[model samples]
Every structure is written in structure tokens, then in C-alpha cells.
Target: MLVAQSSDVSTDLGVYLPLVVMFVVAAAFAVGSALLGPLVGPSRYNRAKLSAYECGIEPSPQPVVGGGRVPVAYYLTAMLFILFDIEMVFLYPFAVSADVLGLFGLVEIFLFIATVGFAYAYVWRRGGLDWN
Candidate 1:
């Protein structure tokens, strides 16, 4: 017959008391600032502050117009850049662990690239690359 011996393992709740106290203090300070700001801060509004003034000179009385709508091409170009950039980001970690990941990693990466390649082809066919 073989006998196995086990050592005693006990966790002390007092070890975590300091962390709990710090969290409570931080939360109280944050809540106090949020509640105090509106009551103590400025409540009055003045015309001078409300109207736009150009450096020490009186502002010209002109109608303010909203900024023009952004071009769809700009958004499309940005999205394309972000999408390809993210693909490269995923490629890095896989490359670093390639030996350990082996054939499974290779197959998964090939599938990922094929999917992204299809998306790239779709973007190309839709005239997303044209700058005009």
C-alpha cells in the first residue's frame, strides 16, 4: 500500500482588504467630483461668451453654416486601409507561433487569406480603388 501526503493550503481574506479599501476610496472621490461640479461651477451665461469673438476684435455679424458633408470615397479609403492593416496584425502572432501551430496553423491561415483576398477582389471590382 502506498500513502500520499498533502500539505495544508489556507487563503487569508485579510490579504485582499487593502485592495478593497483602495477601490472604495477611488470610487468615492470620482463620485464626489461629479456631484460637486454642477453645484459649485458657473451657473450664469453671458452674451459675450455665447457669441463667437475673433481675438480682441468684435466678430462680424454673419450667418454660420454647418460644415459640408464628408465624401463617401474618404470613408471607403479609410475602411480599406483599416481592414488590410488588421489582417496583417493577425498574421504576426500566427507567424511568431508557426512552429508550434504547424499544419493546423498553416491551413487556418490559408483559409483566412482566401477570405480576405475575396474581399479585396470585391472592393477592386466595385471601383473602391479609384481616387476620382
Candidate 2:
């Protein structure tokens, strides 16, 4: 009985292998640079270096919790902006694949838009969008 040699052995480096090797090399370089940096760089440490500097000005003393009371409207506006921004991010992928998704995708997106629009309307009615 003769043994047959495997013919499926790959002679070429796979597409993924190059990516793996690239990542490995990048990691090695990063680690090596980080290790070498402290050894070769200056070892200066002083009181001035330890102090916190704020935009070419001295740091001001303030309460640990916060400096006086601030308006809640500012935070509400920022939160609403972030909420809509994240909704946009979710919709982008669906928009890009609209052609492949066909009518079903259209229905899904319409439902999503309606839900988000209702939320927006509710916020508007509750005065969450108001600046003052």
C-alpha cells in the first residue's frame, strides 16, 4: 500500500498571515520604544514639574464637588445632542445597505425613524430641548 502525500499544503502566505505579522511587528516596536524611552530620556523631576499648570495660568482653588451651582439646561442640551448623534450612527449602516436590504429594510428604517421622531416630539413637548 502506497501512502498519498497531502496536496492541500499552502505554498503562499495567507492574506490573514500578513495582517497578523504586521500587528506582531507593530506591538514589538511599541513595547521596545516604551522600554527604551525611560532609559534614554531625561530623568528630571522637580516641584515645578509636579504642579498642575492651566493654559499658561496658575491653577485656581475650588470646591472638591464643584465651584458654585450651574444651570441644568446646559447638561440637558448636551445629552440630547449625544442621543441624536448616536441614533444617526445606528441609521448610517442601514442607509448604506438599503439597496441590498430592499423593501424589508425600508420598513425597518421607517419604523426606526417613527420611534425616534416620537421620542423627539416628546422631548420637545417636555421642554427638554429648551435652552432656558
Candidate 3:
């Protein structure tokens, strides 16, 4: 019987030096921009600029009875936008690799599109797309 001895292996910390440096640089740049923005940016402040922006609507000086509640339409529209946006995000990868993915991928993508289409139809029926 022959006994084999394994040599001690040391982990190299230098491999991660670039990553650490990059993170530090990014953090420094963000902090520097935030700190410099207030100083370098324009300080011209008027009533309009100081007022709370509600889309393009003019802000009332007096507060509303219920703390000025925003309309549900704003939120619904935002959610619908996100839903479709995520669908597009999923679609890009599938489109890029469609040939490699073959029939199974094609079927899966169609199912996904169908599901999204159903949701779109439901929203349309519910008047979610209506501006007013």
C-alpha cells in the first residue's frame, strides 16, 4: 500500500480585489454625486417648484379632508404597465433562443402570451384602460 500526501492549498484573496475596488468606486461616485448635487444644482425655488407635484394637475394650497387621497386609477394603470413590462422582459430571452428551444419553447411562449392576453381582455372589460 502506498500513502499519498495532499499539498496544502491557499485561497488567493487577490482574485476579488477588482470586485472590491469596483464596489468602492461605485459607492464613492454615488455619495459624491448626492453630496455635490445640492451645492452645484440651481437653488431657484418658487411656489410652483415647492408645491407637491400631482402629475400635471395644479396642487391645492389647502389640504383635502382625507389627507388628499390619490385616485385608484393611477395605481391600476401602474400595475398594468408593470404586468405588461414583465411579460416583455420574459419574451426577449425566449425570442433570442427560440430556435435552440424548439417546439416546446414555442408552445410555452404561446401559452404565456395567451395568459397575458386573457388578463389584458379582462382589464379592458373592467375599464382599467379608461383614462376617466
Candidate 4:
């Protein structure tokens, strides 16, 4: 009937028409703001402001050969820190799901801890942990 056809058209338009309108409005606003900013902003360029700033340390003169080489141990320590940090992050989700996962979760977490511990011990034995 006419009523049924009218209801169907209204239902479809109600869902999709608002979404289309919102998308168009948001896109227009974003583009308008971006384009308007440069026009209204001040245009002043100076040497001090233009120079690369590094937290008020004053940019150091770069050596021709990338300055002196850094120690490998510093990099190794950073890598180890990142690895353990990631492991800790993964543990949180496992801990939250522990109840649902039951003893399997416990076994898996314990195995993970043991593996990480073994790696740490090996590194310690190899003097990777030593600062000197």
C-alpha cells in the first residue's frame, strides 16, 4: 500500500541520510578551518625563531663523522628494557583472563616467566648487565 512504501522510504532515509549529512558537514568544517588558519595567522620569519631548537640546549656543532661512536652496551640495555617492558604489558591481559583460562593460564604465565628469567640470567652471566 502507499503507507507501507512511505514507511520503508522513511526508515531507510532516517538511517543513512543523517550519516551522509554529518560526513559532509564534518569534511567541510575541517577543510574550511585548515584553509582559514594560514590567511589569518601572522607572517613573521626571523633567524632565531627559524633555527632548529633543542630544549634550550643550543644546537651543538655536528662533527663531520657523526661525532664519536657510542658504546654498544647502552644500546643493549635499551633493547633489554624494551623487551621486558613489552613482556610486562602482555602479562596484564593474561592476568585479567586468568580465571576463565584456569590452570592453563597459570602454566603458560609460569613458562613465560621462566623463559624471560633464563634470558636475563644468560645476559647477566655474559656481563651484559655490567655498566663498566
Candidate 5:
């Protein structure tokens, strides 16, 4: 049993080694691009290039003085979509293995759908489904 456990650990580590290497390479590439951009990029500095413009019109020279707040409804809608999408992703795998999982799987899937439905109802009641 001890020997088998050690072998499993070693095998798992081998399986994960490629994943670690891929992550390291991706990180290195991103960091290299960020670092090398300014170093190798253009050295010109001009007002036209640096100034912020909107729709080809120069913005107001005078800065506006006002408090600003973002709408939470947009974020709530996005989060709800992501939550439901992930639930569907889990459902597909369970469906493929339904025969093997049998009665236990059916009960679990029903419970999952019920929970998601409750959340959907709550969001609907809170007006997340409304597009103002």
C-alpha cells in the first residue's frame, strides 16, 4: 500500500510537470513583452500622441467636478450568466456519465437545478433580468 501510494504521487507529479512548464513559459512571455515594449518602442513624446481624445474630438480642457458611480446591474447580469454557464458545463459531464452514476446522479442533478432555479428566481425578483 505504501509503495503504491508513493508511485501514485510520483505519477501525478509527472502529469502536472507539463502544466507547470506551460504556465512558466506563458508568464515569461507576458513579462518579456511588457518589459521590452517601452525599451524597444518609439522614443517620441508629443502632446497629440499623449492627449486623450474621444470620437476624434478633443475633450474639455476644464476637468469636470462631480461624483461618479458605476451601475451594479451590469455586473450582476454578467455574474449571473457566468454562474449559469458553469452550471451547464458541469451538467454535460454528469449527463455523459449518467448511466454509471445511476439514481444518485439523478437526485444530485435535480438538486443542482433546483438550487440554480432558486437563484434565478431571486435575481428576477431583484430586477436583474430587466434591461433598463
Candidate 6:
């Protein structure tokens, strides 16, 4: 019994050895890259290099209006994107495994879709999708 347990422990360790090694290598590489970047990279700083870049558009020194406050529309659009993106992320795995999950999964997914659809409808009704 003791020998059997010892062998099983050794077998488990053997199975996990490659995974452990991979994590160690990944950590070492990330640390090495971070430490080497500043030493190897250019030290020179100029106006162009230091200036905030916005897809080739020059950043305004001050807000054109409203004391530099950003529009709520931008945040609303971002939240909507995140909501739908998370919905898709949940959907993909279920779609791939739908056949194995059977009727219960179908019902659950319908419920999930319905919930998201209600949110979408609410947003549409409130003119969240309107550009202006």
C-alpha cells in the first residue's frame, strides 16, 4: 500500500513537471525582457517622442468646451460594447458544446439571450445608439 501511494505521487509529479517548467520559463522570460528593455532601448527624449499621440491627430492643450470634461456618450458606447463582448465570449463556448449540453443548455441559452435582448431594447428605446 505504501509503495503504491509513493508511485502514484511520483507519477503525478512527473505529469506536472512540464507544466511547472513552462511556467518557470515564461516568468523568467517576462522578467528578463522587463529588466533588459530600459538598458537596451534609446535614452533620447524629444518633443515628438514625449507628446501624447492620438492616431496621428494632435492632442489639444485644453478642452474646446466644458472644462475638459469628456462626453457621456463615449462611456455609454464603451459600456455597451463591453456588455455585448462579454455576451459573445459566454456564447462561443456554449455554441461549441451545444450538442453535448442538450435541451437544458438550449433553454438556459434562450434565457440568457432574452436578458441581453431586453437590455439592448432598453438602450435602443433610450436613444443610446443615436450618434446625436
Per-residue lDDT tens digits of candidate 4, residues 71-101?
A: 7988999998998899999899998899998
What's the CA error at residue 114 for candidate 5, in Å?
A: 2.7
Q: What lDDT tens digits, residue by residue, belong to model 5 across residues 1-132?
A: 436688788988999999999999999999999999999999999988888866555577776577234578878889989999998998999989999999999999999999999999998998889999
Write one digit per residue (lDDT tens) for candidate 1, span 1-31: 9554343222455668899999999999999
TM match of model 1 to true structure: 0.52
Candidate 3 off by > 4 Å:
1-22, 54-62
Computed on alpha carbons, the lDDT of every model, listed in order, comes to 0.87, 0.86, 0.91, 0.87, 0.88, 0.92
Best by lDDT: 6
Q: After superposition, how far is residue 69 of candidate 3 from its true place, in Å?
A: 4.1
- The residue-level lDDT of candidate 1 at 40 comes to 98
Q: Residue by residue across 34-119, what tens digits does model 3's lDDT show?
A: 99999999999997788788778777768779877788998999999999999999999999999999999999999999999999
**Which residue pairs collide, candidate 1?**
none
* Per-prediction CA RMSD (Å): 9.2, 6.1, 4.7, 7.5, 5.4, 4.0
Model 6: CA > 4 A from native: 1-4, 39-44, 52-67
Clashes of 1: 0
Assess every candidate by TM-score.
0.52, 0.55, 0.69, 0.54, 0.52, 0.69
Better of 2 and 5 by lDDT: 5
**Model 6 Cα lDDT, one tens digit per residue, 1-132:** 436688788988899999999999999999999999999999999998999877655698874675456679999999999999999999999999999999999999999999999999999999999998
Best model number under TM-score = 6
Q: Which one wins by TM-score: 1 or 6?
A: 6
